[model samples]
Target: MSGRLSGKRIIITGAIGNIGKEAVRSFVAEGARVVIGDIDEHAGRAVVAEFGGATHFVKVDVSSEASVASLLAQGVEWLNGLDVLAQNAGLQRSGPITGFSQTDWDALFAVNARAHFFGAKHAVAHLKRSGTGSIINMSSLAGKRGGPGLVAYSASKGAVVAFTTALAMELAPDNIRVNAICPGWVDTAFNQPAIDFMGGANVQQQKIAALVPLGRQARAAEIAPLFVYLASDESAYVTAQSFGIDGGVYNG
Candidate 1:
């Protein structure tokens, strides 16, 4: 909280959710002024009110290029510039591969994969000019390992990882760092829908104990510090990296 990200300007998409809210708070606590880009106007405004001076809210439908562009323009205006873009807006559609509808697949990619592209496309110019920009894409452990009925969701998250790596190389010359965080079974309301899709609360608990060596899902606060590390100059040399913050699940 003592100026790790002092004087930085950051934009965080999907800032109303369990994980995203924490990212917004963490960024603010570390001395960064943040623009929260989210579709939930109510929640966004609430966040702005709670954080006061250093935070602003802008409505963003990440699946739309126009919306993403508008968010960037408005955010830059509020912050006076940009330094970090955290692309955390995403959608999860779960179903067996054989039963996955084309509509669901398209929706998943539009929000999860295409949104990252839209964010980076609009933000790169400002970031490149800022000189030490960081782009943090929110992926999931499901991206690295397939889940039984999460084909579309997994595929979309996997695209985030691949996109992050490719964009890192492309942005290296501009000194903008790109990285992806693949979180595993975070204990947040954002994951309740996925848990229900998998089975239910009882089944999810069993899966956590059996599958995760840490024997529990992570809290939103637990996963947030990583965002601070990646966004701060502390990770100046880290780029093109896919970090797995999964309670030992990726290995165990």
Candidate 2:
């Protein structure tokens, strides 16, 4: 690691899971001290232990605005301030529009879409104090191009893209950057919903081969670097962009 993030203080939500875990490792490796926020206390504590002193964990339910506010309050205090916020927590529910209950739809928006807003809403004060800061929201390729069975999930993630764009402009004057990462099929248990909707792992693989130009799913490690880049000063001039790491699924 080149210590690209040396002296940076970061807060990452969903740090117990695949992509979030990998991003935490990458951030720490690049020399950032991080506070992890998640709902699972057991897994969050284990991650803190795994990372030693460079990381701390704060229990949070991203879907709750109060929970998110508390997470940021505690996290910023722990880190002594804040420089980056990675809103990586999300929920996915897939089914036909007719069959998708309103309950699931609301749940999806609460976590996938509204959570980003909640996080940014609370994180802005701490970030502004840093003079320059970054916010990375995780969107998806489904958000960019709505798929057959992903109406709700896609709608929620699409909201993220719009949020990122508008927030970037609003925060740019504060030297705060906002961006979205729209990834395609990354190989993680996180994809189980889509896989089940596709029938099974085998069918998902077949579909990936047909849809992705790279003919495979990306690994979590492959996606973490993008998080690191956005969080670091390397992206000082980058903002308001929804970057696609979808293996050429959508060129636009």
Candidate 3:
């Protein structure tokens, strides 16, 4: 396919999620062997069916240390090696500082923040072996700014950004680059419920074109190529950076 990610073995967490599922398709089309890890058995199996044997599915909670460990072990086993790791699995629950439960706060940290670390930890050895590897973490603009209803999710994402930068330095000597993407509101199923909760009946939908100064919400396909770029040799010198694929929302 003359794709950037050709011949790479990729692992994507939350592979059943809207953006994640699209990523599995794109990465594979671009010549990567992908392993899907998600807690949703049915959804994971459905995705596996769509691609037949091209993908392997792992049932991972990603928040627990043991689950994270197991997922990585299995992911590497399935793919034979890890050339790229996309830590896109996460959960978002709406909450203000006060109404947020200990449960929700902890959950957010475990999935949205901790999973990235575990994924990176597991891939480090293989990445070093290849003499170069890339770690692409999925973040949100909410991490860079304040969002009243998503305190926990925002904080966890901010942690991801910091982690990505620090990791870039850790792996740079190995010729590996680490980066995160700060996507603006994207039209994905997981995020749609939040829009509905925010009193946006076609609200987030209509605002898509106006959300950013460039005038549009990012679609999954639009955001994916960047992931491929960062994970491939195309971004060899780019590391410790968080890119905003916001259509210009971050400009504000």
Give all candidates' CA lDDT scores.
0.92, 0.95, 0.83
Q: Residue 165 in candidate 3 has what lDDT?
A: 91
- Which stretches of candidate 3 lie above 4 Å from their native place? 205-211
What are the per-residue Cα lDDT tens digits for candidate 1 across 1-252?
Answer: 488999999999988888999998899999999999999999899999998889999999999999999999999999999999999887877778898899999999999999999999999999977877999999999889988888888999999999999999999999999999999988877776678876898999999999999999899898889999999999999999989998898973
In model 2, which regions exceed 4 Å deviation?
none
User: How far is 2's C-alpha from truth in model 3 (Å)?
Assistant: 1.9
Cα deviation of 90 in candidate 1 (Å)?
A: 1.3
Q: Which is the leading candidate under lDDT?
A: 2
Q: Write the per-residue lDDT of candidate 2 for residues 132-232, one digit (tens) a residue.
A: 99999999998899988899999999999999999999999999999999999998998898889889999998888998999999899999999999999
TM-score of candidate 2 on Cα atoms, chains taken together: 0.99
lDDT of 3 by residue, 11-89 (tens): 8888887688878888877788888888998999999999777799989888777887788789888888888889898
For TM-score, the strongest prediction is 2
